[model samples]
Target: MSDRLRVPSSVSAARTGAPFIPRVLSIAGSDPSGGAGIQADLKSISANGGFGMAALTALTAQNTQGVRDVHVPPVSFLRAQLEALAVDIQIDAVKIGMLANEDVIVEVGRWLAEVRPEVVVIDPVMVATSGDRLLDPAAEDALRRLLPLAHLVTPNLRELAVLTGREIGEEWDAALDAAEQLSLDLGTAVLVKGGHLAGAHTPDALVDAARALRQEFPGSRIDTTHTHGTGCSLSSALATRRASGEDWPTAVASARAWLRESLEAADELQVGSGSGPVHHFAGLWARGSVMTRPQAEQLASDWWEIIRPIRDGIDELPFIRALADGTLAHAPFVFYLAQDALYLREYARVLAEAARIAPTSEEQAFWAGSAQGAIAGELELHASWLTPAQGITAETFAAAQAPATTAYLDHLRATAFDGDYAVLIAALLPCFWLYSDLGERLHAGAFGEYARDPEHPYASWLATYADPAFAESTQQAIAFVAQAAASASPEMRERMLRAFTAASQHELAFFAAPLTVAL
Candidate 1:
């Protein structure tokens, strides 16, 4: 299966010949409220399309409100979960979030000896989203042991400051400098999430790649109390993307988008009396804007530029093509849609949030109505797809999918959080527009032979893609995203452009022509 079809799911109970799935083992503390720590890590990994497993070092009493009590697990017990998962399941990825003390950190680090997963995304969980220190002083030293081995070490501004003992001093350039210094010191891919610091946009930098991506994402600056799990969410998201095979930079981008959306959407939900949490499934219910035909049509014409490499060789890409054509044989798609429905349920609310912070009510209404329509349509679509004789339970879908390609989502997250509105729109376009185009093209043409000569269950699937309105909406979305991305500096514009290009490639792979290496 193509990475585009990837979903993050770890083998919970090991069995022989288990179908391949992205596995992420999280070593961290547990959050009973499911907002931060290991709980947050598991949710983030699973939500971002990975199989999440956990070995908790501590359990904390907390909610959207705050952490009240913490019970540290004996370090030996922490090591056992690590050993058990490592021994049985093939862990594709590992995430370290919220280790309470140095001993526990060292224990997990030592346990790392046996498993040795390919990708390790360390969140460097030093501080909570509420600005409380979660790791003990000793853990910092243990963290150093894994830095050299980590694929990526994500640190927010404060963590960077604490780790490097350098004042990043509110300047974007300074933060980048600090991140670079940390990378040099640790010899690991370092991501400095500048979300908490001051700036018109939250710019994050990935310092390992030869060409560093110092990006600033522009989005609605949400003023909600539910940001308790942002850090855990972001790191887990990055880990999920990384395990799915994206390079570190792309994974960072993916993590950023997922986290930003969660935060942006949190503005609408009322999870607690103090500060509500961001709704994880907001996208399922919300349709902030209608993707139109012009946008879809233009993409249909231009998509070849991005996807022809993958599409013409379509036969080799049976599973992904199915995703594109909505003709995949798996029953999981129904559950996948159910997951998406839960997500879309809040999509409009998030869009409403975007409008609430938007400069105009017109944009607000557009988003609000879009969310309403999206909710209704999404619910119906999921119901129809799931209500059939399909054995598409949520868990079943979780089990069947493979890992995904995330460069596109990363592009969007970078822009959505730091770029202007136009950039956000541009980043989001491929997801909406390209999928529609791919589905339409295949329905009308390729990937249809799988169905018996008499009928095509893939019928309406293609229509959703071919609709001119869907294409048109894509154009407007492009305009919206591009217009907002008009930056003052050439560098800024170039960065945004790079983000767009990278995202375009991410879209292309979904419909990549199946490559035949036949001799």
Candidate 2:
């Protein structure tokens, strides 16, 4: 019989003869609080798509409040743990954190030499988020020696100050200077995080010894006390994603995005009194009563039913009926196309906002591509209708925005400005699902004489919506909304549903407005 491992539905299973799963090993002290050190490292690795293993270097009696005591395992025992893992399993990446003393650091460095992993990310854990010292003062030199062996070193502002022997003030430029110098001295890439700085924006940069800028990730600073293991999470995520074949810049970008999402969901968790840990699996956890992935998938049909009346209203609209029968007047159709072209420009921006705040790299890229497709595909079709006779240039589209158009665009912008990504995506779903459903329905009937006849005036436009590519995009958008809703809180899920229904109503109004206008 073949050996197949049992795993959580949320995690991938490992089969004996199947392709190897990406494995990441964390060598660090343990925190009893389960927030930082090896605990955080393993969580970060797993959440960022890696199977995590650990070699404990020490144990700390700690809580969210502070570290009380520390006990170092014997160097020989630490060596045994590393060697045992090396002999039994293949490690794709290594995250080294909190090597408490000189002997432990030396042992870890020697093991790195022997079983050299492809990706090594060192989080120089000098000071805790609670301002407690984790690394011994005398072991700084040993940690420095190990830096050259690392593919990347991550240091917060305070740690950067200690490593470079320089003062990093309130200005972000000072930290950048120190990070560049540290990278040069250690001959490695350094990630300088600007979270601790006093500002509305948190900016982090990855730079190399040659002063080459790799990636710069910027974010609006979240106001939350639950930042216990942020550095550990980012560094481990970087290692895991890098080992899984992301380039340096892409790994950093994706890791930072994961860390921000964890911060956004930290308030949902209540672990301790003092600075609690960020929720590592925040994006993956089902926040409402839905317990399984299959249950979540069922929400798609449920949501469609909930919005059925709005769908019916759109299908019954006079404007839609006229278009389906090729009886729509030229003037109203031209006016609608101009307004739609205007609508798409702002809609593209809203999608960009969605991409910026999405919880995962896959989601981010999906939204970004959706934004581009809106402009290049849908808007191009709209523009084609207004040219030659309508004299509608890009400037003309901007000026022709109607009251209904402004209302819809403003509502989306307000939701995006509120910065609740789940709600924003929910608001956007109508543009995809409703349009595709209506187009497909219109395509199936005898009434859609225009859609089937090349001689009909609006045939080309109707085909734009019924295209297979547009249908696939609609399915992807629906899947994303359902997935995000499953991972949102009960209250947040309710908010999403409300947003979806309200936007569906807007879609009905969008089509109806053209009939009332005298173009």
The whole-model lDDT of each prediction reads 0.62, 0.83
Model 1 lDDT per residue over 253-276, tens place:
677777777787886776666656
The model with the greatest lDDT is 2
Error of 1 at 162 (Å): 1.1
Candidate 2 — which pairs collide? none
lDDT of 2 by residue, 20-93 (tens): 45789998889888888899989998888889999998899989998788898799999999889999987878
What is candidate 1's CA lDDT for residue 436? 61
Location of the lowest summed lDDT over 10 successive residues in candidate 2: 1-10
Highest TM-score: which candidate? 2
Error of model 1, residue 440, in angstroms: 41
- Tell me the TM-score of model 2: 0.54
